[model samples]
Target: MGTTPQAGGTVAEPITLSTGETVSVPLSTEATVYGAIFSADRPAVDDLLPRGLEPIRATPRRAAVTVLAVEYHRIGDEVMTPYDEFSVMFPAVEAGERSWPFASLATHGASGYVWYLPVTTEPAKALGVDVWGYPKEVAEIDHDDHVAGRRTTVTADGQEVITLDVEAPPAVDQRQEGVSYTVKDGTLLREQLTLDGRLGAWPYSGQATWELGDHPRADRLRDLDLGERALARLRFDGEFVIGAGEPVGTV
Candidate 1:
């Protein structure tokens, strides 16, 4: 038998970048996550993956502030249906810090947004979009025709950046596997699911669009008939940081 090192004792090496700078990252698991980030689902430009760079221990110069969209696609013998799924997590930087104003919105069926300020001047408007949550799994009837995927498109002044990525499944066909972000111009999109071989192509999807209106956050959603059933059961836990820092790294 071979001896395996303890989990915490296993440290990942640092990676050198083209700009002569380096970053060190700590992986939540031993599995390689970079491969999923660079795969077809979340494609990256050439040199995007620095030489000897690995996600296990790679840290960006700045924290990432992104708007991610998780969409699920279900393929069936006769019908193709899509659902919106989401999960929000603060990175290591903002884990224990005070919650700031990050823009946020949630719709019942499709697209939504979380607008965060990262920093604020007024104390009264301290906690921006205090909580947010998304569905974990999109269900499937036969396990074969079901597929799920997500896409996170981020833009600043309508311009795109190249650092953020979607956490997608490595392979497009694996039943449990999902594709992470696919970067085009500046958007990161990912989808996961199993194809029953019924359709020749992917079906149209939906997004949960959320924004502030005349009423409060709760009332705003109600006006649109979004998620009137289980509003209380929704679990949205995350915080925003407002300061001088970069949201995501640049290539």
Candidate 2:
């Protein structure tokens, strides 16, 4: 593993494993999360994946575009400073059933294939990509909580990639669970993430928009022809946990 140098004083207090190996994780935390999950479907672009790894679709022409802004209030076992993270992912399954994406709208169904994940901290970026194969990169991500809602932007090398605007009204108490997939060492990894908190259904009320910028990453999404109306909008304010991921197969 490469050395993940923590930005001065931002290093959380060390956590020792059973074998005396210290792990990087929070003991507990409170973070505000806001995002949207739109849809995209271009036959030419959608057909790019292998049949075995079928993309999860809303309709024949609609694939999920998920954008997020997560603010870790104080990650250090409460010792390190705080940082915000932004990510863009396509909710995909292993290419099997049509009932999967709907499960997220109803219950915990299938997971997603995260194509791009970017974080504000350099150490987290290194760990996310080098350790977990999470297609991670270091970028400038910011989140501002306003009376209307949360505004988020992700930029790389000073170029804005995408921006999201979602009006957050009073949240409705909710509990949510979902799975995500990633590959490492030729093995399929499934990560189940859960959030037990409050939600504001901004998309249902027509209060959201996704603006893809001119950056390459943004252009990648543009190729998919994401719809103007998000198929799903995720506005969560509560406890978020990425469960211990286990290897599912050597695909």
Candidate 3:
């Protein structure tokens, strides 16, 4: 594990590989819980925006294709705002490759959502999306104060997939919580995640695997050069807060 990054800046920390080799590098901006989606060959219908693309404005234009939301913590650059939102796009008809999603620790006051809309409603389901909730300063925990539930699907055509559901306790308990991960085939392949604690315990211990048949959006994603990159070889650890999402007491 490495020291946290400074706000709006970078952090160089030592990381250990599975083989126990430790090296230090500037933690990637994408490595945090909050940040933008950086993709290759993103499509731009406007054709006039720089790089053949346009900055995502406040309009609901039909151009977005991926979104991720997470919390970030640090003390750095004064010019930029801390990561509270994230979005990414794919070039029209083009695919993405070797991309990483965002991650990070929640701030005392943080909350928002991320979204990715391909804009076209064809059979291609050529859309990408991610979202994050606000962050709040909360206590930590040890062990599993959270119970895990899962939703598995084997589509009519035999496409198998599973989604995990984790329920956080009413009150947090620090000391017994650690970040846990669900890997595929005992290898580092990005699957699903359920975490305990604030913004520090993630990518915990453990692994889970799965296989999928050809998907409907496969071609489009391939054209865009997205999907199936493999969670293999990718690893991270930290926990984040689900700030502002906790419910009020019952009447």
Arrange candidates by lDDT, descending: 2, 3, 1
Candidate 1 C-alpha error for residue 123, in Å: 31
Task: State model 3's lDDT.
Answer: 0.24
Candidate 1 local distance difference test against the native = 0.20
Q: What's each prediction's TM-score?
A: 0.18, 0.78, 0.22
* Candidate 3 per-residue lDDT over residues 1-251, each given as its tens digit: 54655323445344443333333332222212321122223343234222212323212333322322322342122112223222222222111212123221111011112112221111112111111111111111111122331112222223312111222212332312111111122221111122333232222212222222254533333344322221111112243322111221111
TM-score of 2: 0.78
* Best by the TM-score measure: 2
Over the full model, what C-alpha lDDT does candidate 2 score relative to the true structure? 0.63
RMSD of each: 19.7, 6.5, 19.6
Measure candidate 1: CA RMSD.
Answer: 19.7
Superposed model 3: Cα runs more than 4 Å off: 1-39, 44-157, 160-213, 227-233, 244-251
